[model samples]
Target chain A: MKKLINSPDSVIADALRGMAAAHPALSVDHDTRVISRAGGAAQGKVGLVSGGGSGHEPLHGGYVGPGMLDAAVPGEIYTSPVPDQILAATKAADGGAGVLHIVKNYTGDVLNFRMAAELAEDEDIRVSAVVMNDDTAVEDSTFTAGRRGTGATVVAEKIAGAAAAQGADLDAVTRLVTEVNDRSRSFGIALHAGTVPAAGTPGFELGPDEVELGVGIHGEPGRERGSMAPVRDLVAYALEAINADRPVGGDVLVLLNGQGGTPLIELYGAYAEAVDWLEGHGATVTRNLVGNYITSLDQAGFSITVTALDDELVRLWDAPVETPALRWGR
Target chain B: MKKLINSPDSVIADALRGMAAAHPALSVDHDTRVISRAGGAAQGKVGLVSGGGSGHEPLHGGYVGPGMLDAAVPGEIYTSPVPDQILAATKAADGGAGVLHIVKNYTGDVLNFRMAAELAEDEDIRVSAVVMNDDTAVEDSTFTAGRRGTGATVVAEKIAGAAAAQGADLDAVTRLVTEVNDRSRSFGIALHAGTVPAAGTPGFELGPDEVELGVGIHGEPGRERGSMAPVRDLVAYALEAINADRPVGGDVLVLLNGQGGTPLIELYGAYAEAVDWLEGHGATVTRNLVGNYITSLDQAGFSITVTALDDELVRLWDAPVETPALRWGR
Candidate 1:
């Protein structure tokens, strides 16, 4: 693999060290593999924590900050963090207001976060959990028993973070996050598979003229392998799937996310095409984010996320968020 | 060859359209191929304008905002923008305090921006220019006459933009950017070649376990090709080259930028290694940017940019600036 890494075993730790060094706003726990805000959790504010695998960066770790996540526990690449790690993060993030755990739909992540929440409660730390299953690509995948969580995880975290910053209780934060997941859907297409550092080879290979539509973030096989087509056609296919899953209409927030290896120009181009298509079908895109937000470790593809935005959701999203990955109005 | 583009001919236009849609804060003129902050340049403020080839995204277009460039002109991928586009941008961004043209050292870019300035002078608009030649990689390459401008362009624009926002006149802004360029040096390494949409092929090729150290942003031949080494070895080599060109000590601002395809996790890992090496050598890295700021399409590599920072530059950089690609204080 032509990746800039020292050893596969040290990728997460090395990255954590670098993240801590680069962002003074974040404090990394080398022992627990947890990244928390520099000042720890805010007192009397709803504490938020999230984590999954390591490859999809700027996700859990990048989301830790004042207005977003209080702590992020990262595991090995494409693997879930252990329950102990999650428990440690939860405890570290628990302030007087209570803590909220943002867990993805992966079986391992869900189970571990569940155990972590229970463990935190055993220590008398109030904890609530919101499980995200927003990927419409597949109902089940290699590591997931339900729909895989993808782009909407960012949307959920941002809105929930804003709500928490507003001094919302854990239950309110939980409800808002769950509502975001229910109102959102995402679909991805990969032009090439990403090579895992440890594997030293592409997770999968594609024919020169083929792409995997509805590809999972972990490089899992997608809906089908189809011949290469124009970007417009590919965009239409993904949007159609997303629209079908959740009839995209009214004011919606769109995320035209690159799956790592794609260039920003292409993602913007895709965003333009998506906007044109969505407006043509009568949906008004109220707000949008275009870049590599939730990526698949250099997989050359893109994903589209559509979230039907309510007035409160729009207000919360527009509210100040100060995270490494998503920052604005701060 | 695998890219998410409608056609090689329409890449720039499509991307521009998407940029306009995604960032309503900036206005894009399809006819002039320039992206300016919405509502045009701030009246009475010294206008800052920059542009070049389109491939290095979030550079010119993404940097247009209140505290950054007043306007950006983008040409075709890896091709310098025409004098007409530059002239249009210059005219539009000409505030009463005059406009500062931030041109890279590429032959086409310099020539075009010069001609554009002359054309603007014909319209009785005051203009000053700063040509950045900060790349320590090569003195001359396929597309340039002197050192190619690389990551330092971001630093120059950011500081100059801050100066402009503070009501600095054209001359002051020009001096700040020029000094920033002189103080910064950058070196890049490419593990794999980036494919240009128009070419339908990789610009260059590398063996399975090889990398081109000191590679130019446009895939120009670097210092040498060698077998892939550990990330520490790679980091050491890059830092050694940078320190040789400009002995990096004292307080410095470092940017560990991805060459497009490299993931953030790896970049952070590289950042950690760089910090260890720099601190070990008695240099204090006061501020840093670790992400894909300046990119060469989806090239699989990274570049390190270190700017010996002063109190003034730090204060200016810390000032509020809002742009699509780089935003912090604001």
Candidate 2:
């Protein structure tokens, strides 16, 4: 893979160093791979912590700041962080109120975050956890028992972060996060697979005229492979899958997430189709995001995430957020 | 090419539709292909208008907002906007004060923008233009008379847009934009060429182990093609070339821009090396942006831009900007 990296083994560490150099508002703990706000956790507020593999950048790490995550612990590329790393992140995020762990539903990640929560509780800190499984791609995947978590993690982090910033208690923040995940669904399609730096090759291959429907972030097998079609057709297929799982209607927040290598122009084009599809099906988009928020290395693909929104959820989403990846109203 | 577009012919139009759907704060004119703030130009405030080819997104179109451009005109992919479209944008952005056009150094863009400015003057709208040619890779290139304007356009827009928002006259905004271009220098390296949708093939080719150094945004030939090196070495080479053209020292604003296809993690990793190289060469980074701001559709590469900054420029750089792509502050 012709990646702009020093080496595969040092990718996460090197990126963390760069993050430290780039965002002085953030404090990076190199030894523990934890990224937190420069002034530490907010006192008397529920701290939010989320993390996973390193490839999905601007996710967990980029979400750390006021009105968002208190800390992020990135693991190796496509690998879950160790229990020790997660524990360190939990400790760093702990405030007087309590801490909330926003864990994506990968088996490794779920287990590690659970272990870290236990470890934190043993040290006299209160902790609550919410596991996100928003992807409607498949029932099981290579590294996941349930639906693989994808774009909803970003939505969850945002709304929950807003709640925490408003001084919501741990239980209230946990309920809000769980509600966000429950009301959300995602589907992804890949035009090309991303190559891992260590592997130096794409995890899988597709025919020149074929595309993977409902692909996972880690290049796992989707529901099926199909011939290349127009963006409208692709978007319709994704929306159909999501609607089949959960009927999408009413005011919604939409995320048209690019899988790293897709250009912003194309993502915008795809999002237009999504808006049309939603409106045709009785759903009105109230808030939308169109860009690469959760990415998988250099994979050329896109995912559509729809979250049925309430007035409270909409208010929280519009609240000020000051993070590297998602920031506004500050 | 495997792009998420309806068709090669309708890429720009479809993307514009999506942009309109995504950002309600911005108004898009389908007939003229001009994007402007929804509420129209600010009265008595210097209006900022920038435009060019379409592929480098979030450059012109995404920068339309309260603190940025009053209007943007996007042409067909990799093709300059016509005089009519630019003129429409100029008219839409015109206020009582004046209007400023920020043009990149491409031949077609310069010619088209110049024609539009004359047309606007005929209609009694004061118009001033600043041409950006900050690339230090070559003195002359295929589509450019002198250096190719690359990453410096973003810096110019932010600073000039701030000046305009602060009610600077057309002359002052034009002068500040010119000063930014003069103090800035940029260099790019590409691992792979981006495939234009119409062409259905990469603009250029490279050996598996080789990279194109100082490559232009349009896949034009750069300074040289060399074997791939570590991130530090590559960053050092870019910094040395920039330093050779103009000695980089003192307070500076840096942009480590990815060429669409590179991952954010890799961009951050590359940014660390850029910070190190700048500091080692006696330049201190007062501000930095590390992501895909200006891109060449799915090209796997990066460009580094350094702009020498004074206190006023630094303050302007920190000013609030709320664009679709680059946003911060209130």
Candidate 3:
């Protein structure tokens, strides 16, 4: 309930205003709830577009810029953006090369993006989609019918956006996204639940000594809750689950992301433990990010994302990126 | 009392390990507790070095890079780093020109950094110090003798670091830092208290509906406490106080900083409010930063920093920065 917002109803709209003011490079359309690069789509370049519910910030809207997403449509808190907004973003971001819809695997998001793609195609725009289902925490969660997408959404957006910015064809960019998604896996834990602004309370609660493991991004139920242990053990459990499914090894990219509310110091601590665990398992993490890149509101927890990287993916990731949320190598 | 840490005793060391693993561009000396550029000091460049207690992350540590501090020393949570660590960082970061020590105006930190400067003098390394006391919240607090430094540390580091990186001498860099400190003013509000790891609890407490109006970075007592109002009113009050003393006008740079635990969405909302307030008061905010640049450990609130910019500071502000936390134009 202690959130810095005018009202629950205006969080998304007001935040968009703030985003527009803070970053003039990205143009935010209040009417359609779309944030896009100021220059719009480039001719003959594959356009990258993504959208989802609000709350998990710096994900879609924060990623919209030159070397990442072209446009992003944000819905209300933990609710999917309607097809109209998605269609608007798709049309605005589309160039002669085409548009790629980066859809997370939640049921509402996937369905809406799909509908929007169909609508774009009806309007003579070529559209392709890559649905991300990278979270290894659960096969199905409260808001997702399949495995929910989490940290890999960021990894996919960055790499694929770079490929698109390289003037790759639509097919090539879509293939790169598929390759990145195939190589990435994520798992999350929550020390505290994120409060939904509309609800005026946390969706779930934990006892002072309790913690949630294998948590979803929307403050949904996790795999288990237990007495709080040291962060080393928590990180080990999460990474063990991820590496077991993905069989992580060789050169890899890691993102030890904070699930909001957790301080950077603890995220770095978790990053250290995650690196130790991955190295012990014979994985050489060549590139890594440790911060609140993909967050779940103000939930005090962390997520570990391991993406087995190839030279091409590494090159793409190393390319310049300039956005409000994720910017580097520019 | 919930946090993602190993043992309370090992919080700083463990976090340092994580930082070392995550950012290879910066070399972390575990023994001395210093994070410095990987290549050490560049010859003839005025080296910038800073250190303080841990918890306020990305302040000193995250600012060490090509265009920022040459080295950072971190101590235990909310406690001043020792003279030995500061002395070691000074020696490592000192180039032929000199080294600038950016110390926050906490008593222990002032005494420690001053001692280290004397020690560095004995080692024949030129050292100039700038103690920033820019917090407008309180004149004296739990850990400070004078006004405590908060958000302005980041601003001073960025501007002064750019000056030093441009081959400015120690005196020039010191002068630039003093100018930045003089023009910059910051005010913070904590929705909840920050918990120090060793203490196993928040430094203080607030009622469910109450908030500290001008809280210090370490959860020190602020100017006043009142029932939580809409973010607009809260922002107005803080900015009104800052403008009352400084009379903000013309082109100004703003930093709407989140004090850890707040979500990005809320931060952006606060940013929007701050901008509206500033513009309404006849101030022109030309450049701004909205994020968790300087943070209290897991405290839910934010701080507003405004620096009235002249042409020189504006040019220095626009200079390329390639640090782990703050990077742009590179």
Candidate 4:
């Protein structure tokens, strides 16, 4: 229960103020907790918007940049933003070109973003959405609608960001983002649990030498929990699961994401192991990223994401993006 | 440490095999451990190279893209790569255009990369290095030798990568990286310690309810350790240190980096807090990033980086880069 935050209730409010201050390119609607780059809208570009729990940061907000999302709405730590917040961000990012919503497959996120999308439709604003359900962690879970959207959310944002920046219409953006979700798969392992500021303690518990496999980002119970194994075995089990579910035997774009606290070197280890497995399985990883892209709050574990890539995705992946989280193009 | 690897001795080896298999675009040399994109390496172009401990994934290696590093050498988790490994990578990346070493400001990393550079020089392959010392955490403690390099290393590699991709000579690349290092500074705090595989325990320790300020990547001892405070106070402390030391009063590029295990949402919170702090203090943030750019394996904490941006650096920062970690240009 020990954390460094001030009053847990003020964490989100304080954080929003800080984000607005750090990037002049971005602004925060403190009243609604909507975050947009200072540029308001992309003039003639398709506006992309995504948001979810506050703890999976840099997702909606960080990706708000040139080739990425125009706006990101954040909820409190590990909670979904309100529907009104999503509406505000959607409106803020909307230009002449229409808007796209990239919602991770979660009950709260789905319900909230969907409600707002319907509201936007009523307002006569063109809005489309692609619900990302790339996590193979839960084939059938009572807590989730279906597969939980874990790490592949990053791929959705990156690909969709690039597409929107290239002047893709809302439909095009939705198509591409959906394509990314369809092509990508993810699974994760947690060695230690995380603290959800409000709960003030580890979301779940493991002994000093324990680990959980096929875990979701929100500390949902994994498929299995056991004594901590070596990184190699861990990677093997994780990669095997992802490989079997998704069959990444084609040109692939991959991301090895930390669920908050796993170190970069360890992620590399997991990546290295996954690479060997993929190659052995006859997969061609054309692009790769080894870092904490999508994460759970300070959870000590990592996840591997594989997006079976096509030439179009490869091209879109290479487009210029200049958001707070991702940027490129001279 | 209760890690999930078969053995500490073979962790790197197994991981390498896995990486090679998962990423066909990035081929790893098991013998020398040099990772590069297949068919990459512009012939006759000055090759940019960087490396450090294995824990900082997507770093020296992930940044190996068109406008960034040509090769990235990895060491054991949180341990520096030996000189022979560095030399091997340098030689492999060497073209007639010479080689540039993007070194971080750590005793082990600097020593290893420096020795490799010297060896390369003796072999008549012109080499230059930009020792990044951007972390303003512990004054005069950014490195065992001097100031430590933290988040700014990304900026250095990115700028240098762009220059090298444009066929800039080694000297020019070195100058560009140096300029970035000079203009940028970073500070970090650790809410928890990290697990170093070899050590099998945390790299450092703090109370469950405590936070450490001014932490280094390798879990190096931070400057201050105190009871965990609120997010605002924590960010304020970090920002004040950076602002006082580096003084980013004008247009600046801000980076809120996760130390391996922090969630993006938390990082966003930190980013938000940092932005507010900067603005409240009369600082103008031009660009911002919040993610796990630079990490300290499995550490539950975050870092903040600020780079004073000008026209040239911004332009260079905006250049296209194609690497496993960052790809913008195809």
Best by DockQ: 1
Give TM-score values for chain A, per-prediction. 0.98, 0.99, 0.98, 0.96
Two-chain DockQ for each candidate model: 0.88, 0.87, 0.85, 0.42
What TM-score would every model get versus the actual structure?
Answer: 0.99, 0.99, 0.99, 0.83
Give interface RMSD, every candidate, in order.
0.7, 0.7, 0.8, 3.5
B200, model 2: CA deviation in Å?
0.1
Residue A314 lDDT (model 1): 95
Candidate 3, CAPRI quality class derived from DockQ: high
Please give, for residues B1-330, the per-residue lDDT of candidate 2 as tens digits: 788988999899899999999999999999999999999888899989998998898788999997788999998888899999999999999888989999999999999999998999999999999999999999899989998888999999999889988878888999999999999999999999999999999999999999999999889999999899888888889999999999999999999999999999999999999988889889999899999999999999999999999999988888999988878984
The model with the greater lDDT, 1 or 4, is: 1
> How is the predicted docking of candidate 1 categorized under the CAPRI scheme?
high
Pairs with steric clashes in candidate 1: none
**Top of the candidates by lDDT:** 2
lDDT (tens digit, per residue) of candidate 1 on A1-330: 778999988998899989999999898899998899889778899889999998898888999886788999998998999999999998789888889898889999999999998998899999898889898888899988989989999999899889999989989999999999999999999999988899989999999999999998899887889988878999999999988888888999999999889999999999999999999888999999999899889899999999999899999999887778877774
lDDT of each: 0.90, 0.92, 0.90, 0.77
Query: A1-330 in candidate 3: lDDT tens per residue?
Result: 788989999999899999999999999999999999999788888988998999999888999987899999999988899999999999889887899999989999999999999999999999999999899988888888879888999999999889998988889989988888889998888988999988888879899999988888898787899779999999899988888888989999999999889999998988888889889999998899989988889899999889999999999999999999888873
Q: Which stretches in model 3 have alpha-carbon errors above 4 Å?
A: none
Worst 10 residues of 1 chain B by lDDT: B321-330
- Report backbone clashes per prediction: 0, 0, 1, 51
Candidate number 2, chain A TM-score: 0.99
Better of 1 and 2 by lDDT: 2
Report the Cα RMSD per candidate: 0.9, 0.8, 1.0, 4.2
